[model samples]
Target: MLFPIFLLASVAAAATGVIFKPGAWYDGLRKPGFTPPKWAFPVAWTIIYLLSAAAATRVAGLPGAGAALALWAAQIALNTLWTPVFFGARRMALGMAIITTLLVTVAAMTVSFWSLDRVAGAMLLPYLAWLCVASGLNWRIWRDNPAVPRPAA
Candidate 1:
């Protein structure tokens, strides 16, 4: 039950990607040599999100889970914000900022979860690894697409 609840929340966040797709703006970018194939993003992210939700659920009832779960919530919110910032709004710098925070939150969550449940911590490893990849991608895109305008904040 706990896992399902957390998974549902993650799915809702993941849904944002569907709404704010990488359309023509992304298509025209001079992607790095390491840019993943078009089909890979969704595939990788789906697995990562599910694992992250399950990891959070596993530790949600632990004695010291509050901070961990709060970090979970924060990271997911940042996760949801990325697609809109990067793809929908085309603000790569802001997206990078969001994801940078997300990366830190996720690393903290991984450590926090490890203290409570090793298995749960292990579940998040791929997600952490993937975030590293994503951060690199975001940074590369920001660097390569210098002409892209960021909205005035």
Candidate 2:
């Protein structure tokens, strides 16, 4: 049961990427120097989400797990929103800002999880690390592509 929940959460996380599949929508932007290959995102996120879910499941029965779970869910929602905002909506600047916020929220949530169960908290470390890398990448993308108009609406 726990495995399925984790799998589904990872899949749910992946579904967000579907919004960016139409290459026409993203062809105009300049990628950062360190921008990862297209194939990397899906693999990285799937693993991260699965690890996060595993960590979370271990603490499923804990007293304060609800708050930790809520924070986790909120961060995931924020994480999912980033792809659409950046790639689908083409709002790189706004996406960078949002990613920054998400990064902080994930950090806080990680600590919350850690307090509840160390293993669960540790499970989130990879995701937090990736978000830090991502935040830097997002800022670089915005900086490198200064001329592109911010998405309207």
Candidate 3:
């Protein structure tokens, strides 16, 4: 029921990454030695997204889940914003901002979900971990490509 819907929304958010792929612009930029391979982005994102959606679904029916669901919405909205800001517009700084917010919101959701359903909270553990790596990558990318100008709005 809600699981599929949540999953679909995650998939929709993920599509933005595919549509606004890193391409030559991303490839040309310097990345951290620890950056994961290009192919790993989609694969990792797919699993992360699905797990997050399931976590949301698991807690959606709980009595005080309104706040948790709201956090979920915030995280997803911020999640959707990152791909466009970072890749589509080539605005690493702005992308970093969005990703940072995403990291926090996801964390908030994680705690909220945990309070409601530990399983749901646990489901997002991987996403929280991944976002840590992603935030570092975003910061490093912005640092490495200092000369690359931010795209015009």
Judging by lDDT against the true structure, name the best candidate.
3
What is the alpha-carbon lDDT for the whole of candidate 2? 0.79
For 36-148, candidate 3 gives per-residue lDDT tens digits of 98788888898899899999999988899999999998888899989988999888899999999999999999999999999999999999999999999999999999999
* Winning candidate number (TM-score): 3
C-alpha positional error of residue 38 in candidate 3 after TM-score superposition, expressed in Å: 1.5
What is the alpha-carbon lDDT of model 1 when measured against the actual structure?
0.89
Where does model 2 exceed 4 Å of error? 22-28, 150-153
**C-alpha TM-scores of all predictions:** 0.94, 0.86, 0.96
- Worst 10-residue lDDT window for candidate 3 reads 144-153
| Preferred candidate (lDDT higher): 2 or 3 | 3
- Total clashes for model 2: 0
Candidate 1, 1-153: lDDT as tens digits: 798888888898889988987887788888899888989988998899888888887898889899999989998899988989898888888889999999999999999999899999999999899899999999999998999765466
lDDT of 2 at 36: 73
Over the stretch 28-90, how does candidate 2's per-residue lDDT look in tens digits?
566666777878877888789888878878877789788888877788788878888887777
